[model samples]
Target: METTQHRVVATGHADWAGTSTQYQYIGPDQNKHAERVSWKGHAEAVRRFITDLLKQKPPALTDLSHLAAVGHRVVHGGDYTTAIQITPDVRSRIEQLRTLAPLHNPPSLETLAAAEAELPNLPHIATFDTAFHSTLPPKAYTYPIPMKWTRDWGIRRFGFHGLSHAYCSNQATNMLDRPRDELRLVICHLGHGCSAAAVQGGRCLDTTMGFTPLDGLMMATRSGSIDPGILEYVQNNHGLSAEQVGHSLNHDSGLLGVSEISGDLRQLEEAANDGHELAQLAIGIYVHRIRQAIGALTVTLGGIDALIFTAGVGENSSGIRRLICSDLECLGLELDTEANTACQPDADIATKSSRGRILVIATREDLTMVREIQAIIDLSSQGPGGVPQVTVSKSNDKLPGISNS
Candidate 1:
């Protein structure tokens, strides 16, 4: 008899107050089966979804006990540098970070608590989105601020979408058939939450997101990077509260704010196609920031071996990809128009003669979480030497020999 591996993923909750839960099963038959549900109320919906899934008793998973581990995608880990089995301490730490990731952490906590209540026996692991970027060097992560703020307040860049970045990097490595250590990559993860990372030898050198997800490239609603002076100026001149400024930046800006329309790219694209000026401007700004970041990260990497695009807009929007990649002949990145249009996940859309390859990869953060959880479990079983470890191959002291120009 062949064995079956089952996994369940529950995500969403912050964007629009919804939860998307998925149950997947893979057996030796090579056929994979999955069921998904999108409903309102984050924790309650996840609890009910799981309970209802169990009641149906799918052939792949007959009972809740069959689950080996329950993995969660926690957006902010604060000081947590690695994925760990969730304990009381872990839960408490996650709660404490809620203020930092006010939109994300709370729902994740609620889901974790609900899952624990419903399936108490299984191990629950938190695979932080910030964990993968913990490899950032002091020079890359440090902020040019006061010593008190940097040391005492823990104020520094803690890159987000790390799980996606790691997954994309590994997938790109496989697709390129190159050794992990030999490659230098700049990955652009564009979605509701956008970020970019400069990866060399499977390790993160630097990333765009700083301190929080709102600091990176323009996102669906978030303002991305903006002048700190603007915050004070708005407060002093416009008589806005600090909280209100934060709300406006996080909820009112980005594509929505600029276009004065929907925050969603699809909607913006539709409107832009109809010659909506602000919509067109929104698309232009979004692409401009991404292109600028790619160039900056390329300089950070010394050179770029491969440029990978993943997540919602990066994977699906060929037009956006074209606009982003245009006028980059100097960097030796030439997108194959047809290839880009017909691109699938893990597909290479670069011209055969291009020096730097361009890849469109569909990010699998859930799978990354599952792998990290399994690794931690395996490490734990090998007798207690110390805490479990998640290791990435270290790079050399000197940066790779690639020209800045």
Candidate 2:
């Protein structure tokens, strides 16, 4: 009774998908196209942009009757979400938690609404970034906040980047042909917004992000893992309100705040190379925080098997990777000095002589979303009594992979 299902995929980081092809479509025959598309920045706008592009190709929008399900990348699930599936109640619950992740949830909600309008009968599923880390033990997830605040208000650590971490962990396991129960892995998902996760026995035991994506490692503009005392100090000393302090932390901080110039890592890298002291300091701080997280996750996991670097900064930026892994020789982790620096995007850049494996896996959250959607569709087609088993792997051991250049 296993029926085949097709998944319609979407992402928050839609820019990561087929950008070259999309650019080609919007480039020469369409400078005018770019101007019209420019105003379409929101998630809803992408649907129209996509429709117009499809219209230009065939000059018509195609029917989506064959689509089994749509998989959406939802950024936050708070404490209530665990897996990807949708019901009226689930969608409403996601909307209710919007205040927790202002930047991410609004677009996700709009996209959800757009999809419902655009494809009325199709099932939409939400794959949350926080769901994987729901496995965190009470100690790791618990904050020192009052029990009432956490229990009633849902104020606690709910990690982000779970989808990417899950994808990388599974991909690494499959690529290495290692059994899940036998592997311990640490995945570093580095980007403009970054986070790390410790996957033991193929489950997220610990991660760097907490409550919001703003907590954890320093990010492009996010003030990750900040102290609560700072807010009290700001309120008293600077006469800043809680909302104003939040705005400053969420928007005006991180690399942009530290460098006092830019949040773009590429720009920071260039400035650092040119001996800009501020840029150097920002880079130093970023690498230092990442290293600290890695160390903590390693301790949490009791050791490491493979350390994976994915996402924008993790895949291509070898210098930063090197900086993060430097002095970890004591931990038996070595970076292939040459392979790291020469690492290419969308490729696994693992060092040859490293004691523990260092891998560069191109994070494919889109593909993960597609797979999850297909799973949900399969489960749904089985009717009320049939629930398909979710085959999640269980090993989180530290086994290295063969060098894949």
Candidate 3:
């Protein structure tokens, strides 16, 4: 079971024609290497990655034949119940769901097209970010909109950040050394985008995000949950088009909109400490919303036995963590101040007596995708009949924790 982990992420997907890609190779047996290279488009990014990977001394892929399949992380999988092999029809369906996730799905489709072109012989697998939230009951997923809209248009709460939530919840259980069925967990994934999920017995009961990614917690530039009337009002009175209104909420809002400074937390934190009033306000709103979501998710889990934080802000920002946990004692989380600031990830920051443990776990969405791909292959091998199985190579990159064999 050999594996190599590499990330090739594109920037400026808003204008896909001119994009820059940042790639990193973190194979266990190989020293970590990362570089930010400019690629004209998604296709170029894929070409550049494949070329560089093959050129590695102990090449991440000395031969394309040894690579079994390419697993993709699709952010929005409208009604997909599980991972699917990217056949022509499946690809078409994924494309159709683009309107549901205009910002995320378009880039994914571009990436998928590029990867398929480069690895024409290998199976391309898509493991969705929404599949994990399929366990959400009707009460949790139903939108209060008209029945025709939901029934005819397929509009419903299809939460995102499922990969992160799934990864973090599993890691939380491992850290607590508790059985999943016995533990109720609230997992917060805070990064450029943020969301919280409530899981019990390995099933997601509810999540902060709704039909789209922008419905839950306020993100770096996205206005989380805003009054629908406000959109109507602006268009009706201000002569703003729907596109303009949508653009403003999605791009100019959240911390950046409030602070009128920057969206990056590090920047906001510094300005806030320097007595920048708007920066302080932005930080305050961010923490308040997260804390509110945590409380709400805790209730969804019946009560939380553990609260897990993952992703950029959740894992590394101690200041944000302290602020969120300050008044959360009612929810049974007691953060150990010293441990909270000094601890590394996969470590608990809770006091011994706290009823609900506070865990900071680094998310491994890639490993999760690999596992999904492996499961699909393994299932297909069990007497056939499913998305056509791809040949499985016994080796590839080192995925530190997952057993690919």
lDDT of 3 by residue, 275-315 (tens): 99999999999999999988888878789898888999999
lDDT on C-alpha atoms for all candidate structures: 0.75, 0.69, 0.76
Q: Estimated TM-score per prediction?
A: 0.85, 0.83, 0.88
Q: After superposition, which runs of candidate 1 have C-alpha atoms over 4 Å from their true positions?
A: 1-40, 378-405
> What is the lDDT, from 0 to 100, of the residue 73 in candidate 2?
69
All-Cα superposition RMSD per candidate = 8.5, 8.0, 6.0
Better of 2 and 3 by lDDT: 3
- Residue 263 of model 3, lDDT score: 81
TM-score-sorted candidate list, best first: 3, 1, 2
Which parts of model 2 have CA positions greater than 4 angstroms off?
A: 1-38, 41-46, 49-62, 345-350, 378-405
The local distance difference test score of model 1 is: 0.75
**CA shift of 13, model 2, Å:** 8.6
Give the Å error, residue 338, model 3. Answer: 0.3
Model 1 clash pairs are none
Clash numbers, per candidate: 0, 16, 4
Runs of candidate 3 exceeding 4 Å displacement? 1-29, 32-38, 378-405
